[model samples]
Target: MNMLHTQLLQLKPDDIIVEPSVTPLLAGRYRTKRRRQTLHTHKQFDDWVTVSGVQKRRQRSCKVCALLRGDRNKSYHTTFFCEDCSHGEAKCFLYPKARREYNGKRVVLQRPGKVGRRKKTRRELLQDGGAADDEEDD
Candidate 1:
């Protein structure tokens, strides 16, 4: 068995390690596993949203369930249902499918180009500091 596994087996059920020394190794393993699961779930959800049918349907229907059922009594045509299975619009905001649709139309807003100040050229860098012989050769 690995050192960590052996050490873990040696500990009692109720035993707690007070020292920070050993906790980090165990914590690192836990964090790695947690991160892997999180990435897996993210990729799974992304793939589901990007599917051909899902993408087309999401443009017109509610992204939570893709259902068209509406309540006429409340006169809420576009009111979302926030149930246990699907947390309605709140949860939908986390997925891109829900954000792209608008009243049976796909809202296509042009994304602005890359932002932020431009990188300084070698000449500009030399001006900021004393020009070095090595920099001039480059």
Candidate 2:
């Protein structure tokens, strides 16, 4: 009874375990057992409300020509041009002519001057009685 108990204690569960065969046939069988997609041969209809709603949103029209700016026929190759106004040529009446400054030999483009209140000098301020206003607190 002591010898049988010692032998049972020494025996492992892994020693009696049955492992499956690692052959290609058994491996291929498991690999091919995936679920297939179901086929539906009926035609699906699109929601017309959503489609027309997207189409109903108006696109930006040209200010000069008053036509759709996104039109493919009205587009130019190098620059944008209004078809109805300047006969599809690049011309804008609203655009102001750029002022050119001549400095000796070089001619440079001058930006428009800002229209604001000009700063007066100390002499000019004193002449205008502005110095009395500052001296009043002192």
Model 1: weakest 10-residue lDDT segment is 39-48
Tens-digit lDDT track for model 1 on 31-64?
5543322321211122213575445223223343
Give the C-alpha miss distance for residue 114 in model 2, angstroms.
1.3
- Enumerate clash totals for all models, in the order shown: 0, 0
Q: TM-scores for all candidates?
A: 0.18, 0.20
Query: Candidate 2, residues 39-97: lDDT per residue as tens digits?
Result: 32222222133454464322222333222122333422122323334433344321122
The parts of candidate 1 lying over 4 Å away from their true place are 1-36, 39-56, 60-89, 92-114, 122-138
lDDT of 1 at 35: 36
Error of 1 at 14 (Å): 24
After superposition of all CA atoms, the RMSD between model 2 and the true structure is 23.8
